[model samples]
Target: MRVVVGTCGFQRGRRIHYRLLDAVEVQQTFYDPPPKSQLESWRREAPENFEFTVKAWMLVTHGYNLRLWRRLKREVVGDRSAYGGFKLTRENLWAWSVTLESASALKARIIVVQTPATFRASEDNSERVVEFFNNVERGGFTIAWEPRGTWWNNRDLLEETARKAGLIIAGDVLRERLPPRGQEIVYARLHGLGGAEVNYRYKYTDSDLEMLASIICGGGWREAYVMFNNIHSFDDALRFKQRLGGWCGS
Candidate 1:
């Protein structure tokens, strides 16, 4: 099994982290898709064995949250309010296209589509989910879905959707203990503990790291990715690597 342990985003500089970590789930692409040259430059700079997973832009999932729309004003390529939830709107389709191009440039093996807690598992949303995945050309990469909110409460729907679409049900392993929905790829994000669905400020304990390592190593996945999204991601990721008998970077 090939196991990759890293952070949601580099805690230190990319140059430093690139040497110390072999994987990273790019977060910036979700807010704005960077230029192809920049993405390819990143992929080129990294070691050949490195794993780069990109997150789908918010325009693919979240609705018209004016707050973020205003925040991403300069970054917004076009109308920011055009996509959200499970609506396969024109804007959302454009966002997916751009996201795929970025992933191709980065030579990413996985792409994450994370939905906010507000995105419930209603019939409309579920059907939209089916349409979106069925229609989108995922290309050579694996599509991982991190559905937040009540979707977590409905494992059957999540599993059915993933099985049908060939998606991995990526989730916070700390909160919900779910086996890899797909044998192809196992993906997990550590978003800290004890604060809503995500506690970004929390640091993991040694015991927590031990338990995490055990779960990840025990999971029968062909490939596994563990990413730390908490503030203590740097330290925790390093420690987890050590526990997993993993080395730093290539």
Candidate 2:
């Protein structure tokens, strides 16, 4: 298996990150997408084989009430009432268009659509999840769904929907397991296990890294993406690559 390890964002500066790791999951896109020119410049500056993965904008997954909006720039103006919920509304469509454009600029291989804990497992929500993916123009990029809360309870529904829409189920490998279906590509995020939901400050132990490595390499997937989201993400990811005997790459 081709297991590539990297941080969720540029924990180090871009130049250092690009030189040390072969992959990165751009985090700013989740809050505020950078200009297309900037993303294109990043693509130009990185190594030819460097791989980029983009986090889908919150406008497509989060509700307006969520505190995540506080990080959004004041200059970003729009009637956000119709945003999020994965609905087939014009606002959500526009949000997706921006995300697609950003990914296209970076030549990213994956776009991670992360939903909040409130986005629970229900018939209506499930239907919308499938419909949104089916309707969106993915721009030839793979879509990874990182769902939170009770969505894990109904694996059958999750598996069926993913198969129908061609999605990769993303999860914190330490907290949850990736669905066995769609093993062609596995996306694993390592958010520290310190708290109930997610604790970015917690550091991973050596044993945790070993288990994580086991899970990624044990799978039948042809490729695996391990993105660390903890405080020591960069150091941990570098250690993870070393543990894998340096075979992991973009």
Candidate 3:
């Protein structure tokens, strides 16, 4: 199996991070996608073998009420209702286009679309999810969905939708098990563990890394991408790579 380990974002200087890991899931793409020119510059700077995974812009996943919307570079005008929750509207599609362009510029193969927990598993939301996935132009990029909250209550529907849409479910392996079929790669994110659904203050222990290694190795996927999202992501990811015997020399 080919296991790729890295942090959600650069934990150190670019050159230093490149030497420590082989992959990275760019978090900036989520809040505000950078210009293609900037992304291209980053791609050119990284080693040819380095892999980048872009996160879909917030306009594509979060609602107007989401606090992160304040961080958007471009202000949303009137009628913000049609903006998020996978509305399949022109605005959301445009956001996806920008996200795709950013990924293309970075030569990234994976784009993670992470929905907020507030996006429930209701009928309207479900339809929006189906429509959004069915109509979007993938541009030969692997789109991974990270559905949170009540979406997991209906496991069958979740797997069915992903299967029909050819989506890989990017999940926190500690909290949920990814679908066993319909995906060639295993995309796992480590978001820390504590009182809340996603806690960033925690640090992973050696035992946690051991269990994580077992989960990915036993998943039966030919390739796996493991991204650490906690505050200690840099150190934890390095530990994970060592555990998997893929250490890149610290």
Candidate 4:
């Protein structure tokens, strides 16, 4: 398994803790805006064998101009007042691509677009999802789609489309929304084994780690990127990495 660890922020500098990781997930600017220089410096300090995966900006998932209350209204009451002024089109995707490409010099492995839970799966929504992937494909980057809903109800169709387009399925142990197995390349964001989840931390048991390790070992993904969202400090992630390394005999 080719594991990638995630960090809340990478702006401080890469020399901080990236040496302990095979890849680092940049999550700080996913909501606010892009900071090219900070990301670039991370790439410079990262090990030669290291890879980086960045979370797509929130504008891509949450609608750039739509306000929080407006989005809630739309989801709860199906209101269009919030969307009336915003131009949600393919063009905006290019802006995200540009931001992603800013770190191209670092040879990023995958650009993760984690759709909010509000975006449900339906025939119409799936078409829009396909269109989004098509637009992003135009730019030279590999995309990993992580939809929160049970979007893979049509796994055959969704997986076929994803395979044809060369997009990777972002798998998660906690969600199980997507197929549990099978994909050319797999990208997973492991939040934890699941239990009493706090705001940012999760307590993963030994059995949970073993189970995930089994799936990873069984699938034989060309490369697997695992980002630990349970990070309160680096200790948990470091311990998990060590545990996973032992499992893999790395």
Candidate 5:
């Protein structure tokens, strides 16, 4: 069991919150790119045992709303003019690899590419997916895919493809979006056991934690990366980590 917690932004000396855990998922990269200095500073802050996992940028995930995208563009590129020219091509993929390599120096274990809900399962998108994987293969890092919407219907094929490409599926306990239970290398994002309509701030009951612990421990995988996505003001993830630590006697 490799437990991880999601962080909203980079904060100096904040690694103490997750020092007891195995890993931390830096969600800042999903919205904005952090400076190399900040990333290296975090690497120096944590103990050698700690690992980092970063969320893929929204541009890569196609999670752009006009206002949010523009805001992110201004923050990242210093101008909105570069936003329109931004394209998801092989070159952009290479750029992402460079960013991940910098993160690798900080001991990042996996790069999570969480697709937006709009990206449905279709043959057209499938090919693009394969191409994206090919482009990211240069960095010698692990890639985890988390697709929303009707993608789970083609779970078998997608799992096979992911395995062949040496990518990991980002499993979650959300309604109807769970990935296959067993894989040699597994990475999961536990967003709480609630329906889609549920608010992000909803706290996880003991039952919810127990169910997730069961799946993780029962799964045949030698190791699993479990990160909490229910980061809505409460420290449910940290509490859950403490509970899981006790259960696993870690």
Candidate 6:
């Protein structure tokens, strides 16, 4: 198995990034998709071996009313709650459409959909997820979901939904979880964790990297992407590659 590792965002210059990382989970997509010209510019600067994955816009996941329009940089004046969410609504599709444009510009392969902590695991939400995934025009793109909150407690629902939709259930490995179901690829995010949840200030230890390395090695997965999502992400990603005895590289 091959492990493609990198930080959540570019912590260094494109030239330096080309030397240290093989992939990046672009965080800007969640807030606003960069202009196509900018995406193309980054793509041009990156090496052919480098890969990018993007976080989908919050409009498709979070239910924050007008806050959604601000994040998407659009003018949609209405009852904020009526705009977007996990629902298979017109607004959600529009948001995804915008996100896809950026992904195409950057030649990104994976697009992550991360719901906020308030998104519960009710049957209605599960059904909404299925409807959205089934109807969306994916254009050969892979959608990985990192649903926070109560989802962490319901493996059965997540596995079933992901399998049926051909979606991958992304895991935050620092929370001691792996992809709910094995697919051709595995995607993991490591946000420095405290005993309970993400501790953005935390740094990884050598032993922690070893534990993650074991998971990335293989378990019916052909490829694994391990991305760091914390203050020390760049250094943590580098040390993880080192711990793997140089098995990882750009």
| Candidate number with greatest lDDT | 2
- lDDT by residue for model 6 (107-159), tens: 99999888777778877888888888899989789999888888878888878
Model 1, range 215-250, lDDT digits (tens) per residue? 676777777788999988988887887667642222
- Per-candidate TM-score against the hidden true structure: 0.92, 0.93, 0.93, 0.76, 0.81, 0.91
Candidate 4 contains a number of clashing pairs equal to: 0
Q: What tens digits encode model 3's per-residue C-alpha lDDT throughout 1-250?
A: 8889999999888887788898999999988777788889999999999999999988888857657877878656446777788887888888888889999999999999888889877767777788888899989998888888877887777776676667888788887657557477989988898766788888998878877877788778888999999989999988777667642222
Candidate 3, poorest ten consecutive residues by summed lDDT: 241-250
lDDT of 3: 0.83
Error of 4 at 14 (Å): 4.0
| C-alpha RMSD for every candidate | 2.9, 2.4, 2.6, 5.6, 3.8, 2.6
lDDT of 2 by residue, 1-250 (tens): 7778899999889988888887999998999899899999999999988889999999899958657888877344467788888988887888899999999999998999989989988878888888888888989999999888887888887777776777889898788657565568889988888687689998887788878877777777888899998889999898888777532222
Off by over 4 Å in 1: 73-81, 180-182, 246-250
How would the candidate models be sorted by TM-score, starting from the highest? Answer: 2, 3, 1, 6, 5, 4
Which residue window of length 10 is worst by lDDT in model 2? Answer: 241-250
Cα lDDT listed for each candidate: 0.80, 0.85, 0.83, 0.58, 0.63, 0.79
- State the displacement of the C-alpha of residue 222, model 3, in Å, after optimal TM-score superposition: 1.3
- Per-candidate clashes come to 0, 0, 0, 0, 0, 1
| Model 4 lDDT per residue over 1-250, tens place | 5556554345234675666756667665455434567667767777777777777766556554446433322112223332211124544554465547654745675677776656666555666666655555334667787766556566766676566556677757545543435565667676554453223566566666666766665676766666666554355556666788677666
Over all chains combined, what TM-score does candidate 1 have? 0.92
Candidate 5 residues 159-202, lDDT tens each? 76666556778767534445565655567676655467234566
Which residue pairs come into collision in candidate 1?
none
| Superior candidate under lDDT, 3 versus 5 | 3
lDDT of 3 at 108: 95
Q: Which regions of candidate 2 deviate over 4 angstroms?
A: 74-78, 246-250
* Model 3 stretches astray by more than 4 angstroms: 75-78, 246-250
Which structure is stronger by TM-score: 2 or 4? 2
